[model samples]
Target: MDCDLLIIGGGVNGCGIARDAAGRGLKVLLVEQDDLAGHTSSASTKLIHGGLRYLEYYEFRLVREALIEREKLLHIAPHIIWPLRFVMPMPPTGRPGWMIRLGLFLYDHLGGRGSLPGSRGVPLNGPFGAGIKPDIARGFAYSDCWVEDSRLVVLNALDARERGADIRTRTRFTGAARDAEGWIATIAGEDGERTVRARAIVNAAGPWVDHVVGAARGAHPERPPRLVKGSHIIVPRLFDGEHAYILQNLDKRIAFAIPYERDFTLIGTTDVPWHDDPAAPAISVEETAYLCASVSRYFAKPVNPEDVVHSYSGVRPLFDDGSTSASAVTRDYVLKLGEENGPQILSVFGGKITTYRRLAEHALEKLAPFLPPMGEPWTDREPLPGGDVGDFELLLSEIRRRWPFLSERTSWRLARAYGSRVNRVLRDATSLAELGEDLGGGLHTREVDYLVTQEWARTADDILWRRSKLLLHVPPGTRERLERYLAR
Candidate 1:
């Protein structure tokens, strides 16, 4: 196959780039070895924020860019991204009130303040302190965002594909050789090995970026990616409100306890140095204990390792800035455009989810010289598929009006998951029975088919874990039943 850009990664960055490039009238090909967001991207803390703690590292530029993108993303993908208020409790031993107030002040003004509310000091003795320790009487509240991280990635890929980009999931890019005209890349998949021709390449392979660079260029990266493992744990609801708590530890690290999946609290994340396989990173016992301890320190109800219902870990490929500690490394992205050896190849390193879109824009700007002429940037102005539904509450009401058979929860889930595309998933179905057989949880056959046929969901895991967070809510045999259906 021939294309203008060949992207090797299916994470948020890769998919975001593909979407932007394709919308600009470029022939884009994005190849992923597994399902979109099957790795680090799926395992994020599920946040779209300006990395509040990053301010401590003096990453003003990154924070400002991220804060700007935070509102922009919320504007474009309102269904999957929404504003979240965080309550940061003041600890006796942690940074003092004056310093924190200054930090929050910078945070409020950094992004040029948009629709989201500014930060404010709140008494922890009131509702914000419901489950917090009584002794910790004061704190601050600030705005961030909650995101369905994997869904964001999938939506970007879907948008790219709809824009005429060829998005191939479960296809691995082995290597590529440069030539005068462009570059020829090798890719492997279920069909077999094949070669593709492209004028330029983007190595947004996330954690495997260094490895991909080594294979394609026959040399390791000059500044190899630093892999830091971050872990999160899910437990029963920790507190009674829609708000989330950001707990500070004496060691200078912070952990969050956010409301998750309606029935659970998501507590995370610990920064631990990792130098092992990036494919499958598991939370160590120590990391789990640390997370529990971090939150337990402030909450009126103590959390223990035994209370953890589920835990996940992901290795972030950060730019090695010689930071002595893992938590201090910058979260800003670096676009390395290499044209010294041959045709141009841009390798992305050290980026957070909040800034993926900007990263894509910057990447295309870097690669513009080598590739054919393309259109001006437009991804930010338009909504991702299913995001056009304005006034989410009205949409939810309309969905419930149309499908009275669906429970309130199911209706809300469908509305949020597919947005305006919910109708496409429901089609002419007017009753629960018409929706098709129930798999488990709230999943039905109609939705499964839509995912498999439209969303590149080939396996049960893709449907259960990545396409949606149904795994945490579904019953035990749900996977087996879904797997059997997919096999047939």
Candidate 2:
């Protein structure tokens, strides 16, 4: 096979680049060893915000760019992305209140404030104090966004495919050799090994970037990524409102208690240096204790280790800048283009989910000099697939009206998941029975078929976990039934 660009990873950066490159008139092919967003990209705190804590590290440029992209992304993908208000209580011990206020001020104005409301101080006593301790008096509230993180990756890959890019999941890019003309790469899949030619390659392999680099050559790069493990624990909902809390831990790191899956509170994310296999990173006992203690300090109810219902950990591949601590490492991306002689290759390192779009644009610019003249930048102005719906609430209302048989929860779930494409899932079905068998948690066979046919879902986990968080709500035998159905 022949292509213009061969991308090796199915995470946000790789899928984002494929979307951009394919739209720019390039023949793009992306191969992933696992499912799309099977790793780091799916394992975020699921926020699209200018990292508030990053301002403390003087990451002004990074914060500004993220703030700018925050609005752009909300505009382009409103179905899976929407505004989220973060309530930050002024910690009695951490950075003084004045310092936090200054940081919030910068965060509010940095990226040119958009439709979202700005920051303001409020007493942590009334509605804001619902689950808070009595001692903490006041804090600030600011706007960010909540994203269906994995869905974002799938949508990008879907858009890329619609625009002529070939996205091959469960396909591995084993190795590549560069020559004067281009790259001769070998990819392995269920069918076996195959060789393909490409004008260039993009290594966006997330945690395995250095490993991929080694596969291209015989040795690892001089500077490998500093693997920082970030872990999150999900507990039963701690508070009532749609808003989330950003608590400051005594150790200076922050933990968030966000409402998740409607019935659970998602708490997380400790920055611990990791050295083990990146493929399977699990939260340690110490990390779990740390998270529970961190949130316990703020909420009136203390969280214990036993309270955790589920937990996940992802290893971030940060560019080694020699930072003293994992928390201090920069979240900014660095694109390292190969030496200017042979077939061009670009490696991406250390980027946040909020900045993936910008990183994709930058990646293409770096590769532009080596490849054919491509189209101008266009992702910013266009909407991703199914995001063309003008108003989300209006779309939800229409879906409910069209299918009064659907419960409010199901209607909202379908509208949020498929957006304008919900019609395709519903088809001409006038009743729930017509939609096909109820697998579990209202996930019907019809929708599963849509996911399998339209979204490249090959397994039950792809539908339950990554494509949607139905795993948390589905019955115990849901997976087994779905698996059996897929087999048939």
Candidate 3:
């Protein structure tokens, strides 16, 4: 196979690049060893906000860019990306309230925050934050956006496919050799081995970037990718409202407890230096205990390991910054273009989900010199697949009117997950009988079929964990049944 661009890695960066490049009229090929977003991309805190904590490190440029992108993304994908308010409890033990207020003020005004509301001081003792402990008397509420991180990756891949990009999951790039014309790349999949010719190559493999660069056949040694591990835990909902919380740990690190999947709260993200292989970064017992303890300090209801419904860990392929502390490492991305000895190879390092779209735009800008004429930057104004809802509430009402038989909860779920694509998924199905067997909870065989046929779902995990959080709703036995069915 031959192509204009060959991107390795199916994570958010690679998928976003594929989408942007393909839409620009380039013949693009994206290959992933595992499923798309099977790694760090799916394991994010799922926020599309400017990093508030990054302000302390003086990452103004990155934070400003991310903040601007937040509103842009919300406008483009109202169904999946929506405004979320975060409450930061001002405890006497941590940073002073004045300092936090200043940070919030800067965060509110740093970017051109148009559609999202501005930050405000909220009384922690009042009804808005009554659940918080009395010691936390004051707090600040700020705007941000929540995203289905994994689904974002999938949608980008889908959009890329629609724009004429060859997206291959479960396909591995074993090696690549630069020749006089371009690159001769070796790829292996379930079927076997094949060679691909491309004028340029991109190593967007998160966490595996260094491995790819090192494995490139006859390529000069490049700067190694620094790997850092971050972990998150899932527990029962901690509060009654939709707002998320940003808590400060005694160690000065910040953690987030965001509402997730209707009934559960997603708490996370401990940054720890990781020297192990990036492919398998598991949550350590110390990290889990630290997370529970941090939440327990603020909430009346103590959270323990037993309360954790699920836990995940991911390795951030940070660009080597020589920082000793993992938390101090940069979250910004850097693109290394043109190889030391041969055809151009672009390697990406250290990027967050919130900036993936911008990262793609930057990557393509760097590669424009080598490629032919292409389309202009169009993603900033375009919506992702199923994200064209002009008004979210109207979309919800339309779903209710169309599926009057569906429970309000089910209708909301379908609308949020599929957005405008719900119509296609439910085409020609009038009644509950046409929806097929109820696998469990709100899941039905029809929905699973739609995922498999359209969303590249090949296993139970893809449907339950990546495509949707049906695993938390379904019975344990049902998962096994679904797994068995898919295995056949």
Candidate 4:
């Protein structure tokens, strides 16, 4: 396949770049070694916040950029992105209330605060204290956004595909060589290997960034990425309120317990030095214990490893900024344009989900010298696939109205997952029976077919876990049945 750009990796950054590049009228081909968001992208804190903790490290630029993008992202993908309130309780051992107040002030006003609410003091004696200990009385409430992180990646890839980009998941970018004219790339997939030429290449390989660059250029980065593993554990709901909590750990780091899936409290995230493989980072015993203790410190009911129903871990390929602590490293991204080689290859190092769009804009700007002049940045105005509906609650109401046969639960799920595309998925199905076989996990054969044909889902894992968190809702037999249906 001859293309203007060949993008490696199917994580958020890679897909986001592809969507942007394709929108600009570039012939784009994105190859992912595994499923889209098979790794780090799927295992996020599921937050689109400006990293309030990064302020302490004096990462003002990163915070501002992320905060600005937070509102913009919410506007474009309102179906998957919604406003979330975070309550940070003050404790006797943690940072003083005044210090936190100062930080909140900066966080509230740092970037241009848009539709989302700003920071304010909240009395924990009320409903906010549902699971918190009585000793913690007052704290700060702030605004951020929650995202179905993996779904966000899929939507971007879908948009890219629609905009004339060939997005191939389960396909590996083996190697590439630059010559006097453009470059040649070797890709291997189920159908085997083939060579393609492109005018330029984008190495957005996330954790395996340096690995991809090394395979192609035969040179290692002078500064290797510091792989930091972040882990999260899910447990039964801790509080009845919709708001989430951000608790400060004794080690001065912060952890969060967010309300997830209507029935579970998603608590986590421990940052630890990772030396093991990035492909399969697992939550260590120590990490789980630490996360349990982190939330237990503030809540009345102690959360231990026993309470954890599910856990996951992912390694972040952060730029080695000489930071001693894993959590303190910069979340900023860098675009390295390869010169002296034949065709220019841009290798991306270190990026956060919130900044992926801007990173793509910057990436394409870096490649301007090699490719033909493309159109202006248009992603800022375009919505991702199934994200045209701006008002989520209204969208849900509309879905219920249009499909009177849909149950409230299913309507809510479909609205959140597919947004306006719910109409396309349910097509002509006036009854549940017409939607095909129920997979016993709130998953129907219809949804599975949509996932397979439209969303690039190959296995049960792609649908149950990444495309949707039905894994938490599905029974053990759900996967086998779903896979059986896919086989046909």
Report lDDT per candidate.
0.91, 0.92, 0.88, 0.89
lDDT of 1 by residue, 211-265 (tens): 8888786223557888999999999998888999988898988889999999999
Clashing pairs in 4: none
Off-target runs (Cα >4 Å) in candidate 3 are: 218-220, 340-342
Give the Å shift of residue 265 in candidate 3.
1.2
**Model 2: which ten-residue window has the lowest total lDDT?**
213-222
**What's the residue-level lDDT of 14 in candidate 4?**
97
lDDT of 1 at 384: 92
Q: Write the per-residue lDDT of candidate 4 for residues 208-265, one digit (tens) a residue.
A: 8888888786233546688999999999999989999999999999999999999899
Candidate 1 TM-score, C-alpha based: 0.98
RMSD of each: 1.1, 1.2, 1.4, 1.2
CA lDDT for candidate 3: 0.88
lDDT (Cα, 0-100) at 303 in candidate 3: 91
Total clashing pairs for each candidate: 0, 0, 0, 0
Q: TM-score of model 4 relative to the true fold?
A: 0.98
Instruction: Please report how far candidate 4 places residue 332 from its true position, in Å.
Output: 1.0
